[model samples]
Target: MRHVSGLLVLAATPIGDPRDAAPRLSEELARADVVAAEDTRRLRRLCTDLGVEPSGQIVSYHEHNEAAKTPELVARIAAGDRVVLVTDAGMPSVSDPGYRLVTACIDADLDLTCVPGPSAVLMALAVSGLPVDRFCFEGFPPRKAGERARTFAALATEPRTMVFFEAPHRIAETLTAMAEAFGPERRGAVCRELTKTYEEVKRGGLATLATWAADGVRGEITVVVAGAEPVVADLDTAVAQVLERVAGGERLKDASAAVAQASGLSRKVLYDAAVAARAT
Candidate 1:
């Protein structure tokens, strides 16, 4: 039971090639009552590229001011305004702004919809050559070395293929850390400048990708890592893996949980068995 006077539209912009901009995006841009753009300058450029001029008022809406601006946008939606949200590239809210605004709209019981278009996550996964049937998008890994390593460690045994967005400058270090946590030979793909003229997809083991990226990668980066191979479900084997991780400085509880998740074993059982193994 919701009363909606207006519609909040989340529109997807082209990530690289301008031609990828959907026809409906042009219509949305032209007909919207208010256009919330992550970068107004970029929005203007996009309008020029699409050969369409936005008839609506344009306002800057990005991470820095999304919290303060979300309420206003929601109010506009409640007033029956057709508000369109667009980021610099791809769909908004994936790794960009618009999440706050979306939630605000929902809270206000305003209508919401999206003009589905290009997505870097889906694009990267599709071209990654890794199994995309079951995959998870991890967004951007932490920027700090220690934090990044710990993050990757938690997902070390993740069975679903993982996708991550990373800056060009940190791609080498991130891949190196992934190798350390996920193993040197684990397969992965580095997608760079996707859909652009310099688009490149490098598929190789984590160690190889790390080394290749050390030469310095340039452009937006999307990393797709193969999931961990399934481990034997034997309680003893699972416990041994848990103990091994604990010996390597991981907390016993974390190790137990990680192994249990990756191996389809009971966390309580793994923890108990590992404790008993240690006592002996």
Candidate 2:
């Protein structure tokens, strides 16, 4: 039997500036056998703005109808159709639609590919003036005040630089909670309207940011906060805490990471100690 070929392409759209759209993106958009978009209207406007005319069927696939739509797209792909997926901005499946479709395609052994493009997370981190060597994209924080506070509090001790998306209306309240959870002196930057005419990056301590944004904040926002300062302790003490965390149902790796970050000990050293202790 001749081998069958089916492809699922994920194209990243520009977050703000249409000029940032990649050439490969344009090509894939123009050549796709079918295009699954989070918003069909937005996709058409994007095509018009980019001067590209897509020759494929454009189907709507968003949070609302994702569950029902995914299998349909997968069925078409299984029949040797080229399905292209794109979101309103940035890469799909990064806190967006396309995860279900991707999962479905993966399970069906379909070839999955992507057309790379701009990312607001990377752009904000690049200009945030925070350490970019090690960082985590946290998507969006919780909406409710209590949930949001707990969320920030849980990450209070996270040693990796953190990035989060927030609405303009909630920036002040979010920053205030961050001040309490991560500490008033924790350094951070608020990047707004990235890659647009009103683009701005405000960097300072959390308290300063809270005060500055007390009046109001506007536009799409991406906040980058510095990691927690390493906590110093004896090697033996760190190892003991790691064991305790593991006993409390944490994975050895996760416990080791937490202890290492807290004690300023080498993660490998603590991990090795843990292994040896377990063997003993």
Which predicted model would earn the best TM-score? Answer: 1
Which 10 successive residues of model 2 have the least lDDT summed? 1-10
Candidate 2 residue spans exceeding 4 A from truth:
1-4, 234-261, 265-280
Q: Which candidate has the highest lDDT of all? A: 1
Candidate 2: give the clashing pairs: none
Where does model 1 exceed 4 Å of error?
Answer: 233-280
What TM-score does structure 2 among the candidates reach? 0.85
Residue-level lDDT of model 2, residues 70-136, one tens digit each, is 9898888888889899999999999889888888888888878898999999999999888999999
Each candidate: RMSD? 4.1, 4.3
User: Where does the lowest 10-residue lDDT sum fall in candidate 1?
Assistant: 1-10
How does model 2 fare in lDDT? 0.91
- Per-residue lDDT for 51 in model 1? 96
Give the local distance difference test score of model 1: 0.93
- Residue 182 lDDT, candidate 2, scale 0-100: 97
Tens digit per residue, CA lDDT, model 1, 46-118: 9999999999899999999998999889888888899999999999999999888888887778899999998
